[model samples]
Target: MTKAKVGIIFGGKSAEHEVSLQSAKNIVDAIDKDKYDVVLLGIDKDGKWHLNDQSSYLLNEENPKLIQLNKTNKGVAIVPGEVTDQLVNLSGSEALGQLDVVFPILHGTLGEDGSIQGMLRLANLPFVGTGVLGSAVSMDKDIAKRLLKEAGISVAKSVTLTKNKRDQINYEEVKTKLGLPMFIKPANQGSSVGVSKVRNEQEFNAGINDAFLYDHKLLIEETVIGREVECAVLGNENPIASLPGEILPQTDFYSYESKYIDEKGADLAIPADLTDELTKKVQEAAVEVFQSLNCEGLARVDFFLKDDGELVVNEVNTLPGFTRISMYPKLWDISGISYPELINKLIELAIERHQRDLQLKNAVYED
Candidate 1:
């Protein structure tokens, strides 16, 4: 049997570039070599795409901070258009090979915020994770919460602040509205990149500034005191959610450093210590959120399990982390799916979705 060619695109023009590199390395290492011909594509901070060598990129996995798309002089820019999966190299307009499916392991900003997904959709390429609408909606915390609320899902009470209205922010009014110990984060980022837990006026002001550095819009959410739980949702129409996983962050909260940089920053309890009823409820809610957003391929739905056992949707990660120890795969691992198998299943889902979409009557013409 001929192996499928899978393009694993990573390293984006986002703050999570390092995380993307790490995720790409892990996916490349675990993807079944006999089942797929892997292609490594890199996107630099300037958003330039390149055809990268898998092995050479993997070498930077040891110290992801040192990884950059410019590290290799062999630059071949890819322009995603022409309504085909055949990527063209800018150097000579040479064929960069046909791709069966692309697994974009990019976490934040342009990659996960629907920029890359939109480009792939225009190119008519089959790629893993959510479509442009879902990605765009879910990446923006403000819009996602509104949609989730409309879908009858419980989301954190948050006040959206934009760069223009930043000066008008009154700490006292904010404290009275959202209260202290709130979470200030970039409304459009993931992996807790610009997330900060504010306990006092000083931290609240500083957190706002820090969050604004990453994005123009900021979200100040009322802190829900509970265990940070996550559920992995897979498939398209009839998606299934994995067993719940609890995150015990060693730091004040699950910050970017806690998520990727620090080794002992957080601990995961797969199959979180929740009663069967609560677990089922969470899983059901996760699937609901997934379907509500029209997410395809896979997504990791985060939630806060309160002391009274109520589950509030934190946010939906359309393209969550894929490292071996990441919650998405870890929850599935305990739920009877291996890491490699999970990767394969995602690719299959992407292809299935593409095929299904292609069958739709998309055009009308006069005979």
Candidate 2:
């Protein structure tokens, strides 16, 4: 049997670029060589795509803080409206090869906020993770919370602020609304980039400035007092949820440094200690959030499990981290799926979704 050619696209112009490289490394190492052929597609900070050599693609592979894309590979471009010749070398304009599927291990901004997914759709490529609509909605925290609230799901109380309205943002007004020790973050970023826990007027003012550096929009959320828990959802149409996991953060909150840079940033409690009934509730709520957000293939649904036994949906990560210590794969690993097996299942799901999408009529009149 012919092995499927899996194109693993990683690194981006997002703040989480290094994190993406880390994820791609894990997937490339764990993916089954017998069942699939891996292609390394690395995107630089300038948003240029390259065909990286599998052996020497990543730099500083051992250190998460210093790890980066080698950026010495031959540049490539996607060929839209053609599946047979999906990618071509930029220098010679020659077809590189065909890809059976794409695993976009990219996070934040253009990568995770539906830009790459839209491009992939135009190129008629089958990529793992959520579709465009799902990716767009899930990446924006304010939009996601509004939708979840409308769908009868509990979410954090937040006030959305844009860069244009910076002058009108009164620290006192925001404080009164969200209270002290609120969370401020960029609306469309992941890996906790540009996120801050502001407790006073000075911090609030500084946080607003910092968050807007990453995105035009930001969210000022009321800090919920609860234990942080997460659930990983898999599949399409009828998705299943893995057992919940807990995050015991050593820092003030789950900061970017703690997540990717610091080795002892947080402790992950797999199969979080919860009553069977509560576990079922978390799973049910997770699936509900997944369906409500139009997510397919996979997502990590985070929640603040209140001491009163209430589960408030935090946000949905459409392209959650797949690093060795990342919660998404770790949760599933504890739920019976190994790292390699998880990659295989994701590719299978991507192909399945692509076939299903092809069935829909694209035009009223046949060409």
> Count of backbone clashes for each model?
0, 0
Pairs with backbone N, CA or C atoms under 3 Å apart (clashes), candidate 1: none
lDDT of 2 by residue, 1-367 (tens): 8999999999999999999999999999999999999999999999898899999999999899789899865889889888588889998899988999999999998887899999999999999999999999999998898899899999988899999999998888888888989999999998889998998888989999999999999999999999899999999898999999999999889988887888699988999999999899999999999999999999999999999999998889989998878999999999999999999999999999999999999999999
Error of 1 at 222 (Å): 1.0
Identify the runs in model 1 with alpha carbons over 4 angstroms from their true place.
64-70, 77-85
Model 2: ten consecutive residues of lowest lDDT = 78-87
Q: Which residue pairs show backbone clashes in model 2?
A: none
Best candidate, lDDT-wise? 2
Expressed as tens digits, the lDDT of each residue in 1-367 for candidate 1 is 9999898889888998888888887888889999999988888777777777765765446764565554565565545664442777776777666778889899998887898898778777899999999999999999999998998888888899999998899888888998878999899999898888888989988999999999999999998888899999999888999999999999878877777777688988888998899999999989999988778889999999988988899999999987645788889999999889999999999999999989988669745
- Candidate-wise lDDT, in order: 0.86, 0.92
lDDT of 2 at 165: 92
lDDT of 1: 0.86
